[model samples]
Target: MREDFLHYVWQQQYFDKQNLLTETGELLTVLHPGFHNTDAGPDFLNARLQLGEVEWNGAVEIHLRASDWHRHQHQTDARYDQVILHVVLTADQPVLRTDGTPIPTLALAGRIPLEMLHTYQQLQTAPPATLPCAPFLTKIPEITRLSMVDRALLERMERKSATVQLLHQQLDNDWEATAWHVLAAGFGFRKNTEPLARLAKALPLRILRRHRHNLLQTEALLFGQAGFLSAANEKAEDIADEYVQMLRAEYEFLRHKYDLENTGLKEHEWNFLRMRPANFPTARLAQLAALLHARPLLFDALLSAQNVAVLEQFFSNESSVYWRTHYRPGRAGKVPALGRSSMHLLITNVVVPLRVAYARSVGQTEQVEAALQLLTELPAEKNHVLALYEGLPFTHRTAADSQGLLMLATAYCQPLRCVECAIGSRILRHNSALK
Candidate 1:
């Protein structure tokens, strides 16, 4: 009933060609149905047909009604001049092209088999997939799977690079190393990300450079300012012993100066559930703060990191002495170890972005190549996109191929418009050939 169904039937050869006749019962022969152009003009292009032994070679156009030629304004356009045939579902009125010559018309309503219509209707009414190509992925080749996986890992790095570029804009292009650390710290999300970022942002490089000798005091100041003290909240001591008061005064001054409001940050209500003490944001920040206190030039080393292995090494041995013994000040939870997600975050936010930004800062932008190479060090993610590829014969083992799978999943497989996919066309054609 729909015009698209007519197009499908025409393109799929759903009608019998033998013993074909015109409405007036003249013998008809189709030489070429013509190319089905999706754009404007005739529905089919450059057709060759024979009507009553006079071979006609021109374009073919289709419509629901023979009068659509006028309805669509083809009569006013010269592009319809070559239209030799106007095939319609019903021939209600004689149609003509711009030249005023009558185009040979055929009503296809009576020519196509009822069985073909039923088959097409049933096929179109089938269920859709959650992941576009979920149903048909099993038919894909294994080699295609690997290619898609590798692409996904690279896709993550590319996304990380984009995120870093935004941070540069935020920091006014001031501190690439500090910006990378802040953004990388942000990925800890609502769970522990806020306090960590606050600790890093609060302690400026100028302060660290001024009191590089008092590393523990600097660490205690950063940690204390974040309200991480476990020595009870009832003390009213000097500015030095009153770590909370000193840090609070500093943070309040900074907040007003920077026009900032606290975000996802709380002294209490931290996520201790399913988290080890060492991995706790409070503990990690305290540890990182101490390490920064001890080695004021650590950011410089990170800026000079050459590869993923080097970056991994920096993160691997980056913990402080306090983190080794304590998880929290008041709480006596067991110390927890850092996980792989943290490592992934370090590579994505710190290592990759810092490299790209550092390269652009000094006019050596070739670091993009090195950044992308380091991204290949990680494995591809396992998400819905990968699940779709799993349905195919493809066995995804790399990040790049997983990204390709995501591209394929979003654009093709997940939509359930299988007939529109290249693989669907192949499957349909193969089935028809077998039949």
Candidate 2:
């Protein structure tokens, strides 16, 4: 059996406690199980145990076999010196302190109920599956499932917030600049997120703000940094269109004026394979340029947004005039404007994460709550992961719900961490008593 299963049993006090004895035949009573230590010192800390008539307080260590203490070289390490009890699945050998004093040992070989072992075996030995607990998922109480979903959503937000915090640190705590970088990455979507992030880093918010009032110049800076304006090199003779010529000429002037460098970001870094035409890098960059031109203080505006509707309205801007009929520099077609679904994606992934990060950095508790509330207002994201939970007892009505399902699928279900999941815990708790 895995040590984690033993940990679960010991932490929950699931074994028979009617009569306990040490290997030396002394009566043993556990007054306290102690705090389970996740770090290196011991398995549990500050345990209070009553041995015979005397009470002892110290750390407790667990092992599969009593001989493992020596196998792990705990005899040579002072960290195990304070261990008051050696709890093992099998006491195959005696253990002693660094001073050669014999330590009390307790074997849980038969103390754990056989039914519980069967339940654990089912969870651990299940065949390869996406949702290991799927067979018993519907049996869990609705309230328990909902609570786990809520917890999963919060975990996702906390993880995203940590990423934002890292970005904020990288940007030297410039919230607006960090927001711009994150928003650009979001605009890139999955196919081109890294390239878009590189584009934002190469063209700083300060440079973009300098030309924000002039949309053409702002577009020129973005396109130039993204290596789009360099298309004039190979297709010099074909740059007959005035708009392309203007952007090329303007980018050259701005590139020289601001002493800007592309920082090795090439046009080829963008991926267009199998992506929708509207999601092409060219179209996305143009949309981003339009947003940048329109909103110089986009992060500030998002922070002041009292609700999701206001945030939606804030993002409701079409691409620049030149992009109305063009998906790329030379290609011209009726490309769709940024749709509602894409807008929701940006709000959920970019704006909310940014808001949460900024709120946490500035210690504004209410803003963090408001930012999370925005997820509840937006519709749930549609993806294969969320699709796995369709027709299940739970409902996916908002981004929060979708995020929670995504977390469950990736973190818990995919890893077969049934013992750690609330639903899985309940299923095992109920079924452990059945044969």
Candidate 3:
């Protein structure tokens, strides 16, 4: 069928290798199968084979049909000149190399093992309405399942940390606030993550580094950058005044820096229906910016600092005093308070990923456990990743696994590549015989 299936068969040597023959009735002896090249040019590179009494060394290419060589236009390319063999499922035409020399052809349809063929056919077939191997996976040893999950978790962490390293590279190694931005984006959860991360990415860390003392200005810049300067329509004069001058300066500076058309707020489209001010992008960014400005080197302290008491002491009263009573610029709200949600967000997204990233940079596994413990000190998170796994019976629910799940979802699950997932792959293989 597909060339990938043929590749799987050939690469695995599922076909009979003991005795082989060419379509021209010449006895073929295999010396090498060649390297499977995923890059440009031939399918397989540098093969060695014996054609009857003659021995040759070159490349091997495969096709579903012999006529595919010309169909794919490889005959005009000099790259196919070195192809010593052309293995196909069907030989419909005589294939010639770029030099007009006849290329050796081998049809593998009758040469492959019947048992392997049957197994492959059965595994790839349409299921009988149910999943392929549900009963069998349940019978697998619990230890194996646990080991597999653990491996998956570690693999996920390693992969996520690579992203951190790339971000650190982009930031020129101000790993501290990069961690904060990452965690802050996670705070909005999936619905608003991209927008939040965009705010973080758009607002440079240099701005935070410079005005790390003025929390209001910090928030103003962050919030204003996200197109949230709506002080004109606000009912509270004090709230409007708080950001008026800062918003003016921000607009002027932003116009020069970003070269934008308009920075003025359009009052009609702004939505403040049921969302509390603390959750509003304006108030939250301001509060978060204030917090970051208050503690510029917070990430460094978080990494080395072991105790939860220490972190709490550093972050407990870190939000803007205004945020305690107001969620937006001027809605007259008193119920809002800087919740542990942000703290937990910082820990889960920034601190944990940073530690994991640092661990990878230094090749230390201990930081993973340390990062996990830090997240556990905070409350449990509610995200798409956690929600998906919430219904599944998990024996281990450590912060490490939670962080791993976050990485897994953001990195893998959300994109729907479950087939490549350990659990999904395991489930697939378990049902392979019944497919």
Candidate 4:
């Protein structure tokens, strides 16, 4: 069994604790199992324990084997000196603190219920191809599954918020710039997120705002900064297009005007191979330019969206007059403006995260709630990841539910971190059957 299972057993007091004794034959009475510590130092902190006639309050460290104490080199770390006890599944060897004091040891090999261990072992042996906890999914209470998914969703939003907050701090607490960078990265969808983020950072929002009133100039700045308007990037056929030539000339003048000649990206930094024409970086850049030109207060517009319809309308911009017929730089292809699914994705990724980040920055609780409320109004996302949980009762009704399941699948299940999952924890505790 894994070390974490031992931790769970100890935390929940699932193991037999009557007549407990340390390896040194001291009567060990656990007054308090202590708080489970996730950070560095000990596994459990502030433990209140009774060793014989002595009452000790300190940390408790756990390991699969007693030898793990030295294997982890806790003997040298002074932080572990506070360890009042070393609780292990097997007490094969003794341990000492940095001061050479022998820490009391409690072996739990036979103390824990055999049934629980067997069940957890069964889950660990499940086939990896399917969902990590697929077999025991139905056995878990529906409410429990829902609650865990909600937690996963919150975790995802918070994680995204952290990213946005970091960007906000890096941009010197500028919400608009943070929104711009996040939106630019989100517009990349997945394939070109890094380059898109880099492109956004290189071309500041102020520069884009300066030229937003003129659509051509706005597109020129974005396309130019993204490395698309450079001569080395231009295809032989695209060189003769009037719009392309005009854009190139406009970007050169704008670049020189702004003294940004050296801050442009290479054309090869973008990804276009095997992707649909509509979702191409060039097309996405065009849509971003349109959105920037349409709304000067873009972050405000996103926040003030009353419902999904209004939020969706924000992304309904049809780019430019020329883009109505062309999808890429010089490509002769007709692609629709952000499709319904694509718009929904933008709301889910860009709008939701951006709103949450903004709300948290100003410490507005209602605003944060309102930001999350938008997801409940939007349609559920349909993709392979959600499909993995097809038969489960995750509902997948709205973007919120889908978002929860997506977070669970992408973060917890795929990584085989079942021991840390609520559903998996339940299955281990109850020995739920597999499909």
Candidate 5:
């Protein structure tokens, strides 16, 4: 009984259209139902209709009851004066203009098929589930599902591109600096993105570039800025380590040289509660330091990377010698380098978005296409959400497919927006027709 259902029914011509008439028994012919208005004013605008022997063109308004016009006080609003038709589910009262002229009314309560009503009701009243359309997903055509997923993937990319655009603006359109911040955030993964981004912001690329020639200086700057170089916080064993003492000394000199001020991101800001040893913040920062030292022109090289293999190679550099067998400064143990899975995540989240933003800013259509092509070349992501759609009609073979499924789960299914989703719309239409 929601007004959105009525809008859907009218927009799709789901109700019986034969021998249409108004409540006063005048023949009504809809030349055009008008575009549905999502903004303020009428429910529809620029409608062309035939009222008996006369042709009319204006806005159209719909309500669950004709009396709702008065309840909503549209009679006093100047915006509703041009409405040529007031279509309601029930005509409980007459709607008039300011000049005392009666507006044509159409009641669709009896015209809508009982089957359509039943189908819509079932979708709305169904018990809570992962996806309202999950039961009927297989019933939809494969082509229809594929088309929807394609659109969803683009939608997700567009949203991510917007974030990059905002960062670009904040950095005064500096692509390199924006990419640095973005890459730093990506290295943090999901658990510590904010702290890593803060670290990047506190220590600009210019500062890091100055010390790029010496990998130890670059590591000291990054680790020092992250508040991880404090000797007081380290264990006695770590304090006795020669490498830790060297970094502490190097950071002390750099801190004084740059006149840097800590941005209050202490060691506690990083989350290490249940994360794998390889994904520890200390290890990630070491990898980031190595990347900075190896690729002085990180953004430039990424932009010129011809394919996924080249991009993977760009991030394949190993960390410093001290990090080869340690996840943290105080913890010394054999730890693996950045794995392929982590690299895939960085490419998907950081590299692609950065490329898309830069390409869009510089008006390079081919680069944008190349960035999206990289995602299609990469393997699909495995996550809890993807597990929900494991045996669905579509195959998630690449990052593009997984991204599409993520968008579908979050934007469509999670919100129960069945009417707006293509798969849900098709299911509803089929069920309604069957009824």
Candidate 6:
């Protein structure tokens, strides 16, 4: 019933071909259906067809109703003038070109198979459900489902790596800088990623490189650039804290040295309300400072560490004495170092993408596969979106599978794009409901 369904039927030749006729009863012969166009003009282009005793080559346009030609005002447009045939589900009215030449109409109302419509209607008109195909998932074969999920996981990683590629380009093709920015964003977790990335961009890797050997100076640059060195960020009682005062003094000196007076983030750019204290941006920044201070080259470390265990050990010690004792500067509390799950997330989000981007840049195709392989070794991410499939037939359980399910939830299920999904297509095909 939908225009896209009609477009699908037309493109796939789903309707009968025995003794074709345009509504006026001129014998029709479709030598070629033409290429489907997605742009602003005709539905199909460069079509070769035979109408009555004459042969013609032009475009073919499809509409659910012939009256839609007028509804769309294609009669006045020169773009539609090239249309030699108007294929519609029903011929409600006559149509003409810009110069008043009659374009032939082909009505496919009775020609299309009924069962196909029944299957398509189910996919297109499913009720408000998170996964509309959930009811039919049991009908989809295991191999088909697993293959699609694997494809989705690769697609999700590719999408995530695209952001890495853009960062690499913006950082003048420096993989080290790109890795730093990616790790900074990953450290932000979910809420403060943009601000953290902005902070990293403001304080470039070159500047961080000079101070990496000295943890205090590195902390000074990160905290100062994050706008935490300002008095507004300090509590009244904490003003006399010797450690906080020392960092502030050192940041002021560094700020003046690097001429970075106006290039720092505001506190409002970070999100602190409602989230746990451990997940605070302040705690995350301290963790990031520790990583940069210990690891001189982040991208090189990623290249050298192929396995997940190596990467796990590398991210384990991301805390200094000050960070272990305080959640934020001038605040007296115990702060936990990055946990196993947090480290897994950083490796999945930052390390994997960094590997893939670097591999593609250097034309090392196998390294990309090795990078994606890391996901399979890590534990699956546990979240509400994935929790929905707990009792279902989806048996694949790894970070790859979790990522795939998340991708499938957003990119296919949420959009109700089942007709194009592999599982949905197989269900329809196996039931003799589709071509």
TM-scores, all candidates, are 0.53, 0.91, 0.69, 0.96, 0.88, 0.89
Task: Give residue 269's error in model 5 in angstroms.
Answer: 1.2
lDDT for 138 in candidate 1 is: 63
The window of 10 residues in a row where model 5 has the poorest summed lDDT is: 125-134
Order the candidates by TM-score, highest first — what do you get? 4, 2, 6, 5, 3, 1
Q: How does candidate 6 fare on TM-score?
A: 0.89
- Candidate 5 lDDT over 57-106, as tens digits, reads 99999999999999999999889999999999999999998778899899
lDDT ranking, best first: 5, 4, 6, 2, 3, 1
The TM-score of predicted model 5 comes to 0.88
C-alpha lDDT of all candidate models, in order: 0.60, 0.84, 0.65, 0.86, 0.86, 0.85
Q: After superposition, how far is residue 428 of candidate 5 from its true place, in Å?
A: 2.1
Candidate maximizing TM-score = 4
lDDT of 2 at 30: 92
Reference-based lDDT, residue 110, model 3:
75
Model 2 vs. true fold: TM? 0.91
For candidate 4, which ten residues in a row score worst on lDDT?
426-435
lDDT of 1 by residue, 130-161 (tens): 44334444665544445444444445555655
Candidate 2, residues 54-127, lDDT tens digits: the string is: 99999999999999999999988899999999999999999988999889999998888887788677777767
Candidate 6 residue lDDT tens string, 1-435: 668767766776778878999888999998888899989999999998899899999999999999999999999999999999999999999999999999999999988778776776777677764566677788888999999888888888889888889889988988888888999899989889889989988899999999989888889899889988887767774587787788889899988998997889987788998987789898998888888988888888988896999998788766778878887777778888888899999988999888888888889989989999999998888887887677789965789899898888778777766655788767656544335
Worst 10 residues of 3 by lDDT: 126-135
> Between the candidate structures 2 and 3, which one is better when assessed by lDDT?
2
